[model samples]
Target: MELTITSQKKTIQANVLQLHLYQQSKVIEAMDKRNNYYYVVFYQDQFINVVKPTHMKRHSHVQRAITNGISLPGDHPLVNKLIGQQTLSMTRFNQLFKKLQQHYPPLETALILSFFDSFTTAGSIPKLIKKTYYDFRRNGKMRKALQALYLLKEVDAQNTFANDLIGKMEFQKYNEAYQTLDIIMEKDPVYFEDICFRHLQDGIYHENLLMFYDQKNRHIDAIMVLLYLLKQQFNETHWQQLQATIQTWNNEAQIIVLSDLYRDQPHPIIEKELTGRLIGSSHHNEVVSFLLEQNYLPTQTEMDKIIDHLNHTDRSQLIQYFHQSKEKFATLRQSITKNQLEKAITPFIKAFLSTYSFEEINQWFRAFHESNELFLIEQTIHTMEKLQDDPDHQDKLGELYASLDQVEQAIDCYKWEMELHPQNTKAIQAVAHLYKEMGNETEAGTYQDLLIQTQKYG
Candidate 1:
C-alpha cells in the first residue's frame, strides 16, 4: 500500500542526525515552530506517515520509536511491525519491543538508553575522549626516550671509546646530550632520524636532518637540504654522494620524490634534478614547467643551456622557458625552426613574437611556408600585427602568400592594405598587379588608375 501524510500547517520542520539511531537515515524528530512534535517518518523532502501520540505522552518515547524503528538492519521487519505499521500508537510500540527483548534483539534497555543518552551529553564527549590524552602523549614521549636510549646503547657498543661519554650522559649536569646526539647523528644519520622523528615537529632540529633524509635517499631533497644547510658543509664530496644515492632509485620514484622536493623547497639544484629526471623519463617538454610553477628566474648560464637545448631539438621547452621568464631571457635570442614554431601554443607564440626581431620572425615565417605550415605562418603574422611591431605587415603578409603562389590569398591581403591605407603605393600596385595577373582586367585597371592618381597628385 502507498504511504500518505496530512498536515493543516503549510510548513513543518524536523531535527536530524542529532541522534545516532537516525544518523544514517532520513528518519527525524520533526516539529513545527511551536515545538508541537510530529511522530512521523520523513523521506524525500516530505513526511510520509505519522501517529499522533496520547495527550500526555512523553515526546522522548515517540522520538525514540521513530528513530530506532529503522536503525536495526537485521531486525528491520520486526521493528517495522512495531513502529511503521500504519498508525501504531506510542504505547503499543514501546510494549512490543519491551516484551520481546528477551528472545529477539537480546539487548538490555540500558544499551538503547545509553546510545541515546550519549547524544544528550554531546558537549562532554570531547572532554571524556581527551581526559587521558595528555597521559597518552606523555607515554609516547617516554617510548621515544626509551627508543633513543636503546639506540644510544647500540652507538656506545659500536665504539668502546665513547662508553665513558655515554655513561656520563645519565647525569644531566655534565651529559651534554645535544653534543652527544649531534655526534651520533654525524656518525649515523638514520639512527638520528628515528631519534628525531618528524624532525622539528618533534621539537628538535638536528644539525644533520639533511643527512638523515639524504641517507633515506633523494636527488632534490638532498640538494634542497644542501641549500637549507650551511653551504660551507657541502663540498664536492657530499654532492657526489648525494648524486650517487639519487641515481640508485628508478627514474619514476626519482621523479615523484624530487617532484615533492621541488614543491617543498624549489632551489635551482632541485630544478635541475627534477628536470633531468623528467627528461630522462621521456617527459619531452616539462623542463620549463617547474619554472612556471615556481616562478623561477633561471640564471644566464641556465638560460643559455635551455636555448642551446632548443637548437638541438627540445623546442617547446625552450620557448615556454623564455616566455615565462622574459626579463631574464631579454637581450638573448635563439633561432627557431618551422617545426618548433608549429608545435607552439598561442600564448608562447605571442610571447615569442614580442621578443624576437623582424629578421628572426621572418625566418620562421618562411620556414612555416616552406613546410606548408600556412596556418602557423598566418598566426605569427597575426600576432605580429597585434603587437604592431611592423608598419608593413600587410605588405609582408602579401609577399609571403605571393611567394607560395596563393594569389587569391595574396590579393586579399594587398586589397585589405589598400582599403586601410588608400595611398599605400606598394599595396595598390601589388593588388593591381595581382588582379591583372589573374586576368581580371576591369578590377586591375581600376586599381591601376587609383595608384597612378595618388602617385601623380602627391
Candidate 2:
C-alpha cells in the first residue's frame, strides 16, 4: 500500500510493504520501497523502532512520521519513553543515530544530536558539535559553521578556544568579526592582546584593527598602533596610508595623539611623518614651538611650510623662534620681501642690509629700483651713505637722485662718484647732464672736457 505522510508544508510518498519480524511478537517492519529501508516497526498500531533516521536521505520521511502524520501517535508508549529519557548512554546514542542513518538524512541527525547536545553538558555532544563544525567548515559551508559557532558560544561564551574559533569564522564578515573581537577583548583581555599583537606582527588585518580602534573611540590607541606599524615597516606607501587615517580625525584629537608621538623623539623618519603633518595644520605654530622647545629644529623647508599656514600674529611668533637660532636667519631673509620689509622699514632694512656683501646689497637695491620700490630705494641710499664709502654706491645713489628729480643731489652724488673713481665715465657723464639740467653751462662744459680728456687718455 502507498502511504502519504504530510507534515508542515512538506509531503513524502512511500510504499509500505509488510516484512515479517524475526522476534516472537506479531510485528511487521514497514519498509519504504522507494528507499529500500524499514522506516518503522509496528505491532498492533504501536511503533517499535522509535529511533529516528540518522542519514540525510530519509530525514524527510522520518520527520513527517514523527510529526503526528503516520508512523507514530503523539502519546504512544515508545514516544513517551523517548521523551522522558533526559540523557542517553553513549552506546544507545550511537546505536540510535546509526539505525536512524539507515533511514534519515544527515541534517536531521545533526538536528537530533544538537538538541541532545544542548541538554547535556558532557558526553559525546561537545565532540559531535565540534566534528560537525569542522565538517561544515571543510565543506565550505560557512553559514553552517557559524550556526555551530553560535551554539559553541552558548556553551562557553568566555571560552578562549571557542572565541578563537568564532573569531576566525567571523573575520570574513567584518561587522561580525568586530563584535566577536569586542567580546573576546572584554572577556579575555590578555588573550585578545596576544591575538592583536600576533596579527599586528604578521601584518594581518592591520587596517581593520586601526579602524576598529577608531570606531570604538580609542583614537590614541589607534594612533599608537599606526606609529608602531610605521616604525616597523617605514615605507612611503604605508606612511601615506597612515597619513590618510590621521586626516580623518578632528584637530583636537590630532593634537593629542601627535603630541604624544612627538614626545617620544622618534626616529627621524617617523618624526618627519609626525611633524610633517603638523607643519601643514592649523596647529602649526604650536607644533613649531614644541619642536623648538625640544631643541628639535625643523629644516628650512619645514619652517616655511609652518609659516605659510600661520596668521600674521602667529607668524611673528614663529619668526621670533627662528630668530633664536641664527641658522634660521636665512629663512627670515627669504620671508622678507620688499613689501614686508617696507612695513617695518627702518629696523628690518638695517637688519636685512647688515647681512650681505656690499655687492649683494647693491644688487638688492638695483632690484628694488627696477621694481619701482622708491621707499626701499631712498632708504637704501640713506643707509648705504651712513654705512659705506664706495664709488658704485655713489653712482647708484646719483642714479636714484636723478630718478627722484633731485638734480642738485644728483650733482652732489655724481661729483662724489667722480672724486672716488676719477675714471668713472658713467658717473662723470651723469654729472655733466645734471649741470646742464641746472643751466650751469660752465660747470657742464668743464666736466665735458674732463670726460673727453679721460676717454682720450685711455
For model 2, the local distance difference test gives: 0.50
lDDT of each: 0.45, 0.50
Which pairs clash (backbone N, Cα, C closer than 3 Å) in model 1? Answer: none
Off by over 4 Å in 2: 1-189, 194-220, 231-245, 251-284, 287-311, 314-325, 331-458
Residue 176, candidate 2: alpha-carbon lDDT: 49
Off by over 4 Å in 1: 1-195, 198-241, 259-281, 290-325, 331-347, 350-458
Give the number of the best model, judged by lDDT.
2
After the best TM-score superposition of candidate 1, give how far the Cα of residue 321 lies from its true spot, in angstroms: 8.0
lDDT of 1 at 38: 42
Question: Per-residue CA lDDT of candidate 2, range 1-458, in tens?
Answer: 44444324444454444322111111122335456443433321223332224443222323322331222222222222322333211224566568656764443344444333322334465566577778887998775675565545543455465567765735356224334566655543323443564467555446656555665654434544566565555556656655676777665555554555445535566566567667756775576466555545566566555445443234344445433423333334445554443433333233333244546544444444544556654465566465345556888877765764557767888888777789889988888888899899999999899899999995
